[model samples]
Target: MEATFEAFVRARGPALLRYAHLLCGDAGRAEDLVQDALVKVYRRWGPDIAAPSAYTRRAITNEYLSWRRRLTNREVPTQLPEPATRSHTDAIAERDAVWRVLAGLPRRQRVVIVLRYYEALPDREIADLLGLAEGSVRSLAARAFATLRAHPELRDAASVDRASRAEPSP
Candidate 1:
């Protein structure tokens, strides 16, 4: 059982980290989330459980959501930092812009988007993972999509990317 758990972690750790990063939008926080989830999973590690990957992912998502809820009202920043200047034509910049927009979304909405688009999970599965109704999952995704589509920075970055791609090489 211990060897099986070790093998599972070795194989799935990076993907779990990526999923956590998508959920939380910070690499450090993502690592913490994955670590916490793995600890929880390790306690229950046994051959009887089916689909350890799904179980671990659900654990990570639950940890992220609960952590966000705990921190939601406690942290109060006195001042906001100015946004960083980014080159419009840089693909990395475009991805950063999109990530910024995603980071701005409410936690549940962001989770829904990450699960639906990034993880490519069906609505039913997402709903089950989140303990939300399927209709609520759809509504959250709709709102998140609308917010992403309406973000100005994302719009500008996308246009720049499109123009860059469309230009013929000199």
Candidate 2:
């Protein structure tokens, strides 16, 4: 059992860390979340479990979703410095802008978006994982999309990008 658990951790640990980072948008917190979930799973590790990867993934998701964890892990953002002027066509800047918007979303909405889009999971599977009804999952996703589409930062960034592309090269 010990060797099996060790092997599983070695194989799946990095993926779990990535998933946790996507779920929470924080690297340190992601590591902590994965570690906590693994500790819980290790206590019950045995040969009878049918799908260790799925089970471990579920555990990590549940840990991220826990309200108690949220209460304890609340982060107060420090004041950010003024943005340096940069070209709108910069891919890294665009990605950073998108990530900032995503990180601002409500926890459940962000989770739904990440699972649905990033993880390429269907709504039904996400609903099951979140212990929410399918309709609720759809609703959450729609709300998240609406928020993303309507976000001022994203709108400004996108408009600038489009305008930059529209201008003919001198």
What is the per-residue lDDT of model 2 for residues 1-170, given as tens digits with 9 covering 90 to 100? 99999999999899889888877766777899999999999998997768888788889888987933557646632222234355644655655666777777788888887777666777787888889998998888778767766777675556334432332221
Q: List the residue pairs that clash in candidate 1.
A: none
**Best candidate (score: TM-score):** 1
Instruction: Tell me the TM-score of model 2.
Output: 0.77
Local error of candidate 2 at residue 89 (angstroms): 6.0
State the lDDT of candidate 1 residue by residue for 54-80, as single tens digits.
899999999998999887553322211
TM-score of 1: 0.79
Question: Which regions of candidate 2 deviate over 4 angstroms?
Answer: 67-69, 76-89, 156-170
